[model samples]
Target chain A: MSEPTSQPATQLPSRDAANWAKPVDGLKVGAISPEATNLNVEGKQLSGPLAGFGQMWQKTYRIRLSGADVTPEQVIKLWKENFPQFWPKGNRFFGGVGIEPGQVAVLNLAGPGGLNAPGGGPLISTGIMVIYADDESFSFMTPQGHMFAGMITFSAERAAETTCAQVQALVRASDPIYEIGFRLGLLKEEDRFWKYTLTALADFFGVHGAEPDLKIVLVDPKVQWAQAKNVWHNSAVRTGLYTLAAPVRWIRRLAK
Target chain B: MAPVKLDITTRKINAKTSILDIRGEVTGSAESILMAAYAEATAAGAQAIILNFGGLEYMNSSGIGLLVTMLIRIQREKQRLLAFGLSDHYRQIFDLTQLDKAIGIHPTEAAALAAAG
Candidate 1:
């Protein structure tokens, strides 16, 4: 727990410390690296889990750094700085050098078809907006057309004198097609992805051989049928087609 | 300056409506309290759940995630979920996250109760 800082008596209590992002009408991918493909996220509205068509799930992953003498702030700072490094291979993250409120991050995640599929399942280019950031915690909200319409929060806190880092996600498949993919082994892969990330994070903090705790709750089992049309914006399909058309675009550029 | 503390207590609005009076700052620390309060409200057979945020001073992104989880739980039960007493800034938070569309937001508890009908 953070203690109140001594301030001049005139200072007022305010939310200045939270570092929340200014409201935006929709998402804008600003200053992405040339290597990153920004396809589905630009101009899309931010979508909460409620905008999705699949069953809602709340998943929490935690790993305790038992002997590390780091504060919650230190843990979060390290996590934010090395965010992309913890991810598994093949996936790419681009954009901000540091995670801060309102920054957009472009992600080229492995598609649902897995690595065995044709063209190695291609890649799904999507993105998230950093909605809020504080010393001990920060969060990212997915934009419309992302695989999961949801928010994922990364927080570090002390639990019983042990420093614990956590990643909690409240998510649902953005469309019917994603829901089908999630039902067919994609969910387990997603869980493994986070678990591996957490393990890497723990290793970074010098906590070798640490096992992370995973908790998943099915908050809502029924799909929201009204959001069935979200499939029209499937990012995997768009990114795959974009990749497939690279040759044609190159030929046209040569002609010009 | 004391750290934010979240407290939740339930009040009966009618035979079918119950309001969860939420006080203090809501952050990552408030998760258990909020979940317990929601469980209590539902266990008492509330068809409509209204969260009164009148006394809330601050809420971080984690708090918003908690609300979304509660909303899903409420939806699973087919119960109505509504919220009231948001300061303009907090209302904007709801808007930016699109939670305003998921759960109805009202300016006052009375207005929320009226809408529960």
Candidate 2:
């Protein structure tokens, strides 16, 4: 869509790629960065997961669930509905990077996959993604900020009649030109993930009299996955990023 | 000057692999800390390395970008680099941004280290 923001000194992986498909419970992720950290702010800049930003932010999570029967498709569906919420710029999509027609899908909200606001704080991902489903492998540009951000992979193995979905999402980001999403786990703002996930588990099972032993390793922007989500039938007091107060204040502040 | 604390601690999973635990904010001077750690590991002749995000708290774009740089370098050296411990939010960011295609990530450091070796 946009011309190369900066001349990427760091080259790309030299191989062909394949598209991703939903599969089992496997997780893999890593980064690709630029040789230089500073971007020409006068020129365009980018950041977020799908981006190849050099340095802005990162968090990691690994989840394991064992039950009567589980399938990767079920997990992938849950992932698509719930997972997309955590993506950058809140739910928008650029079908495939070029300025091709029907390429951009601008989401109007903040908590999913599109920008939280119009002209500030929100991030833009810029990079190239090369996926290889046949080889059970994939790759893309890191430091996705100045170019593109995000890529998906899925691998499934059906043991008997059940399937475990093995998946990975990678990001290479850069600090945004705008100061939208940044927090320091301030004021024990870090403690909410445990409270949320545990409470959710208790309430869902208590209220519905239905028990799903879901162990979620939440790699919170602030807290550890040792606790957080599904288990907590609790309010999303804050988005995945932890906070003591409601984020309305922050969002309001961002708007102002 | 503050130490610009960039700590890279490695544990040998076996002969051909080491899991490098990178913590602290990968911003400002710390960015270089990660860079140095990666470079040293590559030079140390480790066949494969797993980057453990379990200990890290926050990382910005520059931080992620720097890792990509490390990935390219590692590939050149014929070494394998994998990642573990990323959260759902960060995972979505990477997925949408396509970072998954850049480096290898495993559910655990053991798998990543083992894959490269």
Q: Going through the candidates in order, what is the number of backbone clashes in each?
A: 0, 103
Give the Å shift of residue A30 in candidate 2: 31
lDDT of 1 by residue, A24-59 (tens): 987788887787767888888888888998999999
- Name the candidate that leads on DockQ: 1
Score chain A of each prediction against the true chain A by TM-score and list the results.
0.90, 0.30
Runs in model 1 deviating more than 4 A are A1-18, A111-122, B1-4
Off by over 4 Å in 2: A1-256, B1-6
Q: Note each model's CA RMSD in angstroms.
A: 5.5, 17.9
Identify the leading candidate in terms of TM-score: 1
Give the alpha-carbon lDDT of every model. 0.82, 0.38
Error of 2 at A156 (Å): 44
Candidate that scores best on lDDT: 1
Q: DockQ scores for all the models shown?
A: 0.33, 0.06
True contacts kept of 2: 0.05
